[model samples]
Target: MTPETVMEIGVQTMEVTALLAAPLLLSALVVGLLIGMLQAATQINEMTLTFVPKLMVVALVLLFAGPALLETLLGFTIRLLEGIPELIG
Candidate 1:
């Protein structure tokens, strides 16, 4: 592939990765932020307080987004595999 093509592929790969990860990541971020706020408000400085909610939120996101995420990854993989010969040729 040309440099431009390689760059394009790289950018697309990153975009797909970010798209797949965004829901779970954003959920975790929001949960963490909420936990932080709660901690600040109550002056409850327990480090572990953040872990359970974040884990639960992440798990919930994965439960909800799992199918879509898997499909996205599968599609990306299939496209990449289909392009392999073109990439080599």
Candidate 2:
């Protein structure tokens, strides 16, 4: 493939990756921020207090968003595979 085509593919790959990861990452970020605030307010300062909640929220997010994420990744994979001939020739 040409350099432009390669770059385009790279950009699309990154976009798909970000889209798939955003939900879990965002949930973790929000949970962590809230936990941090609570820790500051109450002076709990326990590591597991932060870790467990964020872990649970992330798991919940994944459970809810998993199907959509899978669909997006599958779509991207199919599109990339279909474009292989054009890219090669």
Candidate 3:
């Protein structure tokens, strides 16, 4: 309820969001970079060339990181719910 508490909650929310999104975003970035390099070297300027590989990499990353991501989100949710009583008190 307090400004400090509200700010803390907002910061934690942002942190959790970033943590959850990092893997997918990083995979996309890496795939894009590699595709860019390949396109530059081969002079193939196909705009859609990067999409499929990025999608596949993202899928693979999600497949591998899904459990840890779920665990992290679940932990954060449980912690947030548990803190409600403390915040109210």
Candidate 4:
């Protein structure tokens, strides 16, 4: 592949990765922030307090958004595979 083609593919890969990970990551971030705030307000500084909630929230996000995310991933994979021939040539 040409340099531009390689760069474009790299960018696309990063975008797909971010899209795939965003929901879970974002959910964890939100849960962590909320938990932190609650801890601060209550003076409950437990080191492991955020773990379970973050895990549960991420699991919920995956459950709800999993199918659509899979579809998106599948579409990207198909497109990338289909472009292999052009890249090789």
Candidate number achieving the greatest lDDT relative to the actual structure: 3
Candidate 1 global TM-score: 0.94
For model 2, state the Cα shift of residue 51 in Å.
0.7
Which ranges in model 3 have alpha carbons more than 4 Å from their true place? none
Write out the backbone clash pairs for model 3.
none
Q: Considering lDDT, where higher is better, how would the candidates rank from best to worst?
A: 3, 4, 1, 2
Q: What's the candidate order when arranged by decreasing TM-score? A: 2, 3, 4, 1
Whichever of 2 and 3 has more TM-score, that candidate is 2
* Candidate 2 accuracy as lDDT: 0.93
- Models, CA RMSD each: 0.9, 0.6, 0.7, 0.8
Which candidate, 2 or 4, has the higher TM-score? 2
User: Which portions of model 4 miss their true places by more than 4 Å?
Assistant: none
Off by over 4 Å in 1: none
Instruction: Tell me how far the alpha carbon of residue 24 in candidate 3 is from the true structure, in angstroms, after superposition.
Output: 0.8
**Candidate with best TM-score:** 2
Over 17-72, each residue of candidate 3 has an lDDT whose tens digit, in order, gives: 99999999999999999999999999999998999999999999999999999999
Q: What are the lDDT scores of the predictions, listed in order?
A: 0.94, 0.93, 0.96, 0.95
Tens digits of lDDT, candidate 2, 30-58: 99999999999999989989898999999
